[model samples]
Target: MNVAHFEGAGAPPRKRPWTAPGALVVRALGNAAAAAPVEGAMLRFGRGRPGDPGKPVDVTVGVDDTKVSRQHGLLVHRSGWWHLSNTGRLPIEVGNHVLQPNGDAVPLRAGVTSALISTADRRHLVELCVNGSEGASPAPAFGLHTAPGHVWRLDERERLVLAVLGQEYLRNNPRAQPLARHQAAAQLAELRPGEDWDVRKMDRVVEAVRLRLSGQGVFGLVQSDLPQPIGNLLSHNLLTELAVTTSSLTSADLMRLEGAD
Candidate 1:
């Protein structure tokens, strides 16, 4: 069971496969009292029905329903165990995968659980053997590729957030040229909902970009709120000199002449 965010209300539906290579088959015991009925559906990765003669249940993951953030994939296992894996820059613990067994909903193992590991054997998924320019053969269960080209269009807020990333880049590298106007604008459009894209976050985010580019930059709101981890993510996301410069600055800063104190 892959946790995919589907825009079910006719919003460019992602193609669903009958079966995927790494898809996990899960068993749902019962509904959680705390859990509300949510939208978005789970599809098996490969090509067969989950013919477990238990519960014909559904598992879902998305912003509107599960509130699972930043995780690339989620699987509720056959033994009623849940596993969340990172698609981006974070990881979910094994304890975080526990289902609500017995009493009020509780995490699995109560913090004694192991880390989330792939159950797939070497056959289901194989690393590509790169043989010079000729490349290698495809693996048996090729999964949904989240390539950059697969990016859904960015909304206005997301674009602004992206712009903030650009601004951070510009603040540190004063000599760099500006970002492509259209590119910056498009990125701002793709903000995840309710993101403020505020100044303090923007400042450190900018500094984070600088640090990644030159291996050094600023952090924190006044050195106190300096978020080292988030800064690192920002750095990884914004590497180019142009992405660094414009993503770091605000409109107010932009109004001032470059190098003006």
Candidate 2:
């Protein structure tokens, strides 16, 4: 018996047909859509009407989201090469790049390589060979540029997602507290209340609890202040942190700390 495999069977064969060396063309659809500057939408809901002038001109990468509006400003010199600053209420994600060109739609040619970001998980997925384009369809905002270097257009939703995720990330990160216990408790209480109001009483209550749990490592569950789900998450997170500290620190290390001592 004889078996044979085709030349491109083991791997995707390259098929570059009049394609640019390292360029990507993305359609202004999904969350990436935005209205053109003048007669354009603040958000690209979907589909555009005919005879719309001052359409979101094709923009290049490197433009900031905040500066995308007031085109006359960012477009300082290049009149033909339009620019966009992310103006949407959304966050400026370091990832997530899209390409949408005007006039003509071009599919990624066979053997061409590019990365598409998953709108759901925010992960890179799908390396394709022989991707096709239906040609430039009407898009509120689109981009034509090289692959994976800079991003220009960022929509509002995209910005929001990034902001929320970033805040969550920072919330989870641990930090060392150089401040004394009294000073640290004062700061934490301040974050929850107003300067004009009476915060000292509240601070005292927290300090009492902080003292009781100082060495035992059990911060009493104060169910009165937390929403059920948030409380659960907070408790889970705090306990996890405590477990790590318990495992990593020696009794001497805990004793050396002024307050814990």
Candidate 3:
């Protein structure tokens, strides 16, 4: 059952499928050939050894890329899948998509996905491969935490809209990029072919989402806040205190939204 987050709306939380992978292989793509198995669920990448051994990041890059940060990025292991989150000084680009510093992560799809870490100091190319993930794919789940005691859940449409915008924000200009808004409208249109959609309509939906957040006593999303919550979202950076990032997207959510399931 779909529970709208309009007024007083909620449903029980869902537990998505979580599968453990056999291993993650990271390869340095340069001069010769070198490979390593990411030890645990979390891997941290960078040039030198981590200053603090207690830090939980799991991967390290042994390359000539001096520009790479000690804590460049991370491949965090979730319940069922692995997601790439940028934690470095530079952006992490994967599959032609770029993630800003501390930007939203992308789920690891099948096959090898390489990310380019570009910096004036050093440029490095690394590829990630998920070896032998075993289990049934889980349903996609979206959620939000507005206030300390309040929570909001996104319906399929809302989830899809935010996801499209989030990814677009990462791909283009986070601040001035119009791709997110325009592309989101296109995505929403694909979801509901019976209705007509324009940029203005999509704006209305976004405004409505903000209103819902404000109505729930969340102050950061309404009117004009210094951080500009909507602007940040438009840039694909999630309101960690309020919304979930695109990395949380599930195959089931995609299928149902596209009417594929």
Each prediction's whole-model lDDT (CA): 0.29, 0.27, 0.51
Q: Rank the candidates by TM-score, best first.
A: 3, 2, 1
Q: How close is candidate 3 to the true structure, as a TM-score?
A: 0.40
Q: After superposition, how far is residue 30 of candidate 1 from its true place, in Å?
A: 30
Count of residue pairs whose backbone atoms collide, per candidate: 41, 21, 6
So what's the TM-score on candidate 2? 0.19
Q: Give all TM-scores, in the order shown.
A: 0.19, 0.19, 0.40
Best by lDDT: 3
Q: Model 1 has how many clashing residue pairs? A: 41
Best by TM-score: 3
lDDT of 3 by residue, 1-261 (tens): 011111111111222211223344444532111122223356656664433564422344534666677778777655445678887788887754568897777666544567778778565776665544452223334574453444467775566665454443333332323345677788777766667866787677666766776676544455343222244442322332233322344444545555632
Residue-wise C-alpha lDDT for candidate 1, range 1-261, written one tens digit per residue: 233322221111213221222222221121110111122223221111123333222322222322232232332222332223233222222221212212122112111123322322311110111111222222234576664422223344333444444454435442233354444433333343245434555555455434444443322212232222232333333433233323333444333323333
Q: Which stretches of candidate 1 lie over 4 Å from their true place?
A: 1-38, 44-49, 54-261
Residue 147 in model 3: lDDT: 38
Clashing pairs in 3: 18-80, 19-80, 43-58, 43-59, 44-58, 44-59
Model 2 has an lDDT value of: 0.27
